[model samples]
Target: MTKNRHFEIFLATSPGLEDMLCAEVKLKGFRQPKAVPGGVTLRGGWPEVWRANLWIRGASRVLARIGQFRAEYLNQLEVRAKEVSWGELLRTDVPFRVEVSCSTSRIYHSGAAAERIAKAITETLGVPRSETADIIVRARIENNFCTLSLDTSGDLLHRRGHKEAVNRAPMRETMASLFLRKCGYNGQEPVLDPMCGSGTFVIEAAEVAARLNPGRSRHFAFEHFATFDPEAWEQMRAVKSQRAPEFHFYGSDRDAGAITMSRANAERAGVTAYTTFNQATVSDILPPAGPPGLVILNAPYGTRIGDKKKLSALYRALGQRMLEHFKGWRVGIITTETSLAHATGLPFLPTGAPIPHGGLKVFLFQTDILK
Candidate 1:
């Protein structure tokens, strides 16, 4: 019989991406996931955890909650920590680390709490609390209520195990996915990224449409857990058979080097058949051959140089081209600066999701029709 597992999963995301993360979780079948400031909390088993890690594009990491308790005092924390199911979750040989965050209600010292929890894991589970931990388990003490979670994905899933090549100010995969979802891309319509840098948007969209598992080619921290079932994980990974999609995913960059890197990244992602890379400027982009789809661009805002003389004209030209060519389609534009976005000259509204990228707050400007 299969175990009726009950575990907590935390979907880690950027500061402004919490709602989108929760929305993605719900879209992935989680009926009720509590949206916190930086992430979401849900209860489920290993299967749900695996699926979230595989399909959640906005999530950086998925952590499985293992324990929760209230400790008003350090002595109570020590006592409550002893009753946790450490033997079931950790092995004697595995190395682990404790990360603690504390708020009101008597847990005043976060470092002390983290040390106590690490000691408890070491004493009870026989697992050494090594600094170089294969897995990072998170502990949060809010109003003296403590919650423990184990990191399932060792690294951020947006790494995608591909993207060896990128150019100046390349957008992150997580943000790219969020913007695409905001555009309502269903993978059935043609998608184009005229300013594609390293093909992040196109590659991630292809992965989504083909039903490919984003974590298939990557490794996770949960694989090293004591309760990890290799056979079950293998079965889950077998679902990665979804390959090329029928919709066309076109990516173009003015730099020939970017186009070459896009093709290489696409091949590595195993979605080359569904993607096309070209060396073309945004002004040169023509309407796709198939039905009208979405056009997304993360143009240069010249944040560091503070030069707007040329980029302003670029934005105006971009808006002009979209108005002239992509008449019936939709467009999604992410910009670090509002003034540059205003120069687009397109009829658009704020997506209400302000995300952080490259240490700067960004917003998504979307228009269903280019007027």
Candidate 2:
């Protein structure tokens, strides 16, 4: 059993994606991480923090819970903030930034409260505060209680620090993982996306199948803290190669440009060696030589283009293709319109939740049997 620690860590994700993120955390071997409103809360120590930064594909960011206190007013907030031992978490040479959010408490102005907390850090620990610091600690208050957290993962962990070439309407990493989870993808079998724009589905599926660390290539803010252990981080990174699988991940896009983008994105993700990218339309979709598994697609949902009628034919054709060719394979489609999904013609059950994708509401449609 991994030794338990007094600390709590949170892995934040976009709203409505919490369940998927929490499931991914558990699948990656973290102990009981509870799904919260915007994130998952896990009980662990610094080693877990390092592991979370190196792994945890679905998290938008990882935060370490440093302190929690009740403050009905600014005077109480300042006094409480000053009492905490900021020196233990910060150093004079290292600069930091603070973000604040408040709800249902006397501390109404989050901006002013954040300023006060930043001032407290500078006054109490002598650490300079700056907007562009490598470290950004956040304080959130609700019902007159404040919880302070340090962002362990920098750059909004969803950035993955990869995907230099992404097309418009590219899916966020957090959303991709959540969608994969909802589609029942476990990285244990073959997965493909015929409309793999930016390779979000394909890349995330490959990452899971190859057992690659999603955050491995990125830098985290926790590294700057004085308490961050280099040895622990190294140990976490050393497991990268041990997790790779022995199979190829497949993805194809109708757009030649999207195919190129997926290949480039997969290359940067270090999973290209295990990925196969092709250029083909849904009509050209074919079964892989391997056993059938999950098939997920995020096609043009007629969202930004403002032409549902034009895309209706496209969606209808896609449904016909899936029904005719993809028998016995689990199929998942994400789209913004119920009528567009109906156009697919394949019998599907609504996943019953709205997920935020590309600033539009997307619902997942799944069909277990092509017939």
Candidate 3:
């Protein structure tokens, strides 16, 4: 167990966007943030953890590493787990769940390892265990070393407690923010998503430009922790750095239902004043009345059999429209197939590393300002 309040906090993000996430963490003034394989790691206490959850747009979840020990067997694990100061972190009245993973360890049975630790918590802290509990205790037993962490964010950070309505295959807000960073957006320029499904890109851009906190509307599991300070958290949340954006973000889709969903989502996210949604197809999309900016979209790529040919034609049409109409504007197109991206014939720079999204490998194809 940690003798002091400070602990290592891990901000989990999608695999391929670690660099962008690290950039955001650095820009946000996080202390000594280091990019790892799956996410970024920083050293801080509870307050830093809370702020990361509230402000970091690219993180999918926040984890607090509480304690660790070496245990070669289940008996040793149970004994060592009981020795940790559970009362310092967990409340007896609250229910929690334990999830464990084991690899290359003598105590290789993850189920048994989880059971031993859960038993220790139940016996030592008098807390009840439930599979559906919101408070999570995660344990990993790898190479004879055991590490324990607490899931501070109750739900995924992408939920954001807003955006109730969504379209099919909607882009997550976390992914959208990272992609925007990848496109070199810094809240000063305008953004447009021509095939906006549920208005994710536009709403995210508006939120970034307005300097809104993503977790302002939501509750976290850490609120129930014994170490949580409600007063300090309230003060942190009360401080707003909101700024007026100079330009508006826009989204348009061929489906009227998608436009309706996007409008509702934007309103719920409190970006309606800075965002606009329209019902229009890709061929009909026109540049908004402003200085040239970014045109980013997550177009549909046929995942099923025989869907690629039709999507190819759609891509060609999209490319032709942008080539003819949108001069001096950059484009970021996300798709699963390079052939579909090739159909656009946009002067795309080198394709980025493939990002795993919705069980398919997707890559970002970007271009300089179109001539």
lDDT digits (tens) for residues 160-274 of candidate 3: 9988998888788999999999998989899999999899999999999999999988999999998888999999999999998999999999989999999998989999999
Check candidate 3 and list the clashing pairs.
none
TM-score computed on alpha carbons, candidate 1: 0.93
List TM-scores for all candidates, in order: 0.93, 0.94, 0.97
Q: In candidate 3, how many Å is residue 10 off?
A: 0.5
Name the weakest run of 10 consecutive residues (lDDT summed) in model 2: 1-10
What's the lDDT of the predicted structure labeled candidate 3? Answer: 0.92
What alpha-carbon RMSD in Å does predicted model 2 have with respect to the real structure?
A: 2.4
lDDT of 1 by residue, 167-187 (tens): 778888887887788788867
The TM-score ranking, best first, is 3, 2, 1
CA-RMSD of model 3: 1.5
**Cα lDDT for residue 357, candidate 3:** 84
Q: 1-371, model 2: which lDDT tens digit per residue?
A: 12244588998887888888888889878999999998899998878888887888888888988889999988788888887778777768988998999999999999889988888888998998889887887999999999999887878877888878887777787788788888887878778888888898889888888777787777778788877777877766876454666566778877899889999999898888878889998888887887677788776767755489999888888888777777777888888888888898878875676876667888888888565
**Top candidate when judged by lDDT against the true structure:** 3
